[model samples]
Target: MEPDAPITIFGPDFPFAYDDWLTHPAGLGTVPDEALGTEVAIIGAGMAGMTAAYELMRMGLKPVVYEADRIGGRLRSEPFVEGEPEIAELGGMRFPISSRSFFHYVDTFGLRYSPFPNPLTEAAGSTVIDIGGQTLYARTLDDLPPIYREISEAWDSALERIAGFSGLQAAIAARDVTELKRRWNALVSQWDDRSFYDFLSTSTEFGSLTFRHRELFGQVGFGTGGWDSDFGNSMLEILRVVLTNCDTDQYLVVGGAEQVPHRLWTHAPQQITHWPAGTSLSSLHHGAPRAGVRSLRRLGPNRIEVTDRWGDTREFPAVIATCQAWLLSTEIDCDEALFSQDLWMALDRTRYMQSSKTFVMVDRPFWTDRDPVTGRDVLSMTLTDRLTRGTYLFDNGPDRPGVICLSYTWMSDSLKVLPHAVERRVELALAALRKIYPDLDIAEHIVGRPITVSWEDDPHFLGAFKGALPGHYRYNTRMYGHFHDQHTLPADEQGIFIAGDDVSFMPAWVEGAVQTGLNAVWGVMTHLGGRSHPDNPGPGDVYDALGPIDIGK
Candidate 1:
């Protein structure tokens, strides 16, 4: 049977068939025997780094992974304690069903997942939308006020009218790159410079609604909190989220999402090249990864040298940097000429959004208790205009203790809590929630100390994830297309590649990290005289036609 076309989950602007590419049985590419035993230095042990190393291992290449902290990177699952049953997802928690690349490993590892409690999702037993000191409870959107309904309708109509939502979604579902690209490129030209707020404010459908209705829509979005914080961001970013159905039908990994990478570290699947059948990443590296990469420099043609924090150094025919882009200049001493001036500007200008989360352990699923007056759950997944922009409830089971993300704030709200202690952050969030659930003694059910994260405060990550500002499409295009530059760049720059969510068109999404990892794998394989099967071409194989929209020109 013929191979199927690549699925267009990310649209034409970032055309890459993640599902087809990941599920392909022929494998990504085959390296020659001479290149089989060669080593490839992979910086960072995050999703991208692990993924690339995993695929390359199958191709028979040795991958030496370097990690500054732990192996999981942003897919962090903070267990309450050693034997504690509960965990707080300090980094990536919920994932959309549409992320095929991310799920490939999840399914590969036999990990289980349950629906995430986001707003009106079935997993979310009840929802409480608190704004302007007024509180409302609902099971679905219909239970909300008529204004809320109207606003929701306006958004649907606006997407349909302005962006051809139906047509684009159908194209994406069909995996029609030609149609997806045409529609998305047109949108790129039209919306790249525009803000998400501009799209909402000027929409005829939304214009008919009252300003307060619009404000409510911004505060309590369909599945998340108010999107006002995203208003200043490029419309293309919002379009990508809606187009991909990223805000709904999501699931949380049962044990911990971090297990995906951890499993890959030791998993020895079939069809491996050089090593024996039982060879695993952990076994190959003696169950320990090298320390963080402190410097990267092009030493000679088609070769790069990496220096770790301990002054340890190694040379490889190729190197893939999976750390955050800013780390190249901020954390690592890299050769300036390794990347072009334009690419450097794009990397330096990459903007990451601030995000903070405070999670507390509870004695049980106490929130399931019914209210005397409203006849609804005493507490629910919350979205409010207060400091706690979004609050979530996680139930381990009726018998076990539950976890509650007391607060999930972003941007300005995240910055506000940067200086607060974890206990203080939890206290402040509980204080805000008290206004909505005054009768409920939320603090009484607390089981242990609270856990918190300020991603921006971490030197390695710098921030939560990339939030493309207006006119950032050009920069993103350059970064996403860096793999193809290997052919045009000087010989010294050919071996060093960049892969991570930050380097992908869809930053903040694990799928981006996975897809870019695959892309970099393809690039690295070819750099060592390997080639993908013609029938199963990699992203770079057809990148000229499916590359990102060049809005800068």
Candidate 2:
């Protein structure tokens, strides 16, 4: 914990101190001598899968990783050209400092990062809000008209009125678990069935203002850009973001976001249980992870057989599936008998949100170049109701070429251009931006090919990340708590533990994936007859007594 780490993603759902557990002097745990070097199947090579694999290896267990596309998974960063440092973050960029668990690994490796250029933040020098064919430029909220400030105030007042915002945040900052759980558990029951729009539309503050206020609020959202896309999601989901400060104090990895997981894959802990000091996941598997998984079935009692895409099959004592739960039915040939009817239903009902991002590398940080007459930068971080919902500017340095996220959108906005190729996507983005910066010819500065991504279009990732809908609390609880409850399930079902951001209450954040992965580690250790140190108890050790609220179906 850094001095007074303002806020941590410490469970409003399951308040486990994963950050503390990771930094504890006492190691994770020790497996039995006989169980040492036992192979455990790890599906997916993303942050969640890699985190679990890294810890499992430190404990002297062999983690056989299966990656479908790339090792980084959603934490993907692609370069603009052959060897240039300027890169486009295809997925999982702009991480929050409150994501203590995810940063644990990043900080361990000393990965450099800078604050993200959010809508109104200092990192984004100036911001432009264009809506209804009108444009307003400002460096801060106060610089905007009174209406913008009113909208911001109303949101704060509404949160305090309806959710006890101050006290809730105070509890979290203070790390008061008892109060945090008591306040949060109550909120879960109240807001779980309610939608985010429902919270806004029904609030006394918002209700007092006109509908246009709500619209403006959506167009110019807090922390980042417009959150209108998440309007249909559960209020609990929205509250979690603000409560944990998930939307504020965000930073981007210097080299790339993918480096966190890639480094984890090859990281060698200072003190390992059964392996040599220099041992790492890369060394264990020779170099790269196994190809994607094709099928998963129970070979015998407490034994799971996994087949790779190329028809290579192997059985392991336990399997930690870090891939999206929805993929169990679609991408992999998972045996139906592996999970219970209720668990299967939860996995099936898990909804995902679509997302799209288009990026390009420019000759220089041209946005910083001021106009001769107006003395204003040529362009500013933009948020608009147009096709391009948000346009962010990234300045590498005077020496390196700057990168621009020409457009970033979600949900229906993303699906609008789902079928388009990268070139077509860039064209659409430019067409929309031209409306605001009509005089600026963005194409003149393009140095390399444009890069774009539509997660929904990708087979491996059917959607960006989990976004729970109203009345989906029961489903989230089932998926997240599965690691702890798996012990009571039937023999065949007990060993295959599920983990990922989708399996966590705080989905769409890397910390969610990291925390859930830690949970899976505890589940696997316990399943293999291992136990955590007495002083430092794992999540599973205290989960039954203090887990998520079970708001029954």
Candidate 3:
């Protein structure tokens, strides 16, 4: 990284330099002497919750973290067997390099990473696109037929026509907040009410081409795989992804993405305020977090009461809730008066997208071998229109066992096998792969039982992440702005806040979670009579001027 790295994840909606604010030498902020040793309740020990807790601990406050399950929430990586070292990444496997805030923690922990084997990238070695009863293999986009290249060109033209792709990206690279808001605010008004498919169909470039061109683009979309499942999502959601480069230059943590948060939980800041040099989040909690929070209610004047599942109740001056939004209504028995009716409406209306993954450990990296009949790989990283929407291959080493994500699907596709067991899911995937590679026997090489996860099926996480629909920008604004805007609310509601990717502009990205967590740090500090260093103003300081524009009623 450069000496002064520009934060690429600086929002198109809220253009705050979270990476810079976090890494600044001045530190996050300082709490009053009276507030020192004050306890803060952090519900759900996920990425956002953990980030806020860690930072708050640094400022001399004791953070009480509660978790329903393991330390890493959606960043789960389950080992294949009790004794085996290799594992399958059930969630958040691929991470984009442009997510500067997330990578900040990665570099801090001194963890290793490698390129994720996404479709059509050099790391994959080979990619196969199988659609409409036809199959083709490629080392790059140019290796495919002329029609595929034409579809790619059409998509590029469409983006350039509607989004001013080059200029907008230049602003992001330069961190020009003025030009960014001017252009992005205009887009929020025009595109907020439209769907991704609407953006594609209405573009003059795509309009000039045949319907088949659009269909082909959907099958082999840029970054990751087909995005047809996201056709129903708001156009603003898709634009934020491309504008922030969320889907490009992605890599996976060497062992698993879960290690990032785990390290944060145990990391001790060298120059922490109010605490001893060796004190860490783990030492503060006695090496174990509290049980899951079952209920939450306000106690007025910078006080909130939290009750764990085991009926252990505690009160704190400030609280940060990082669980999925839907969980507030369903799993946790939260009080009605903690927020306004409008806020509740926004939380209830937030839509979530479903996702599923199935994985199996193979004997070895056999897929990399060349076939006798054809001089190509025996099996390639695959994309298909079958039930198995996408298949990814992970090559551990020449001798070590390799792992294969047999099937990965989203939205409607994820629902198809949600009722089936892991074995059935693997069977369904292998059956689909047979059509793409008739001679290959994927099931025969499998050594152990398969592993799978349907995020929608998990009660704790009703769905994978928030996928806002058309006309839902108002709801998104209300949720994302709640922390800063809560100052106008009643005293009881002011100190209780929400943080997570679900409340951020760029949902599903780890950077969003980290940014919101930092926002909560600012909010909590200000509520407890603390202030950020004058040299480095926090998000709340710039929110009024730079926050997302409100599309008025």
The C-alpha TM-scores of every prediction are: 0.97, 0.99, 0.98
lDDT of 2 by residue, 153-183 (tens): 9999999989999888888888777898899
Estimate, for each residue in 1-553, the C-alpha lDDT of model 3 and write its tens digit.
Answer: 3445443888889998898998999998999999999999998888898899999999999999999888888899888886566789998999999988889999999999899999999889999999898899999999989888887887777778788877777778888899988889988999998999998888887888888878877877877999898898999999889888888889999888888889989998887888998898899999999999899987767668899999999988888999999899999998888888889999999899999999999999899999987899999999988999899999989888999999999998999999999989998999999999999898889988789999999989999999999999999998888889867888767888899999998889888889999999999999888899999999998999999998997
TM-score of 3: 0.98
Candidate closest to the true structure, highest TM-score: 2
lDDT values of the candidates?
0.88, 0.91, 0.89
Q: Residue-wise lDDT of candidate 1 within 479-531, one digit each (tens)?
A: 88888779898776688889999898778888889988988999999999999
Select the stronger candidate by lDDT from 1 and 2: 2
Clashes of each: 2, 0, 0
Provide the lowest-lDDT 10-residue window in model 3: 1-10
Candidate 1 positional error at 340, Å: 0.6
Alpha carbon deviation, residue 141, candidate 1 (Å): 0.7
Model 2 RMSD in Å is: 1.2
Among residues 3 or more apart in sequence or in different chains, the pairs in candidate 3 whose N, CA or C atoms overlap within 3 Å are: none
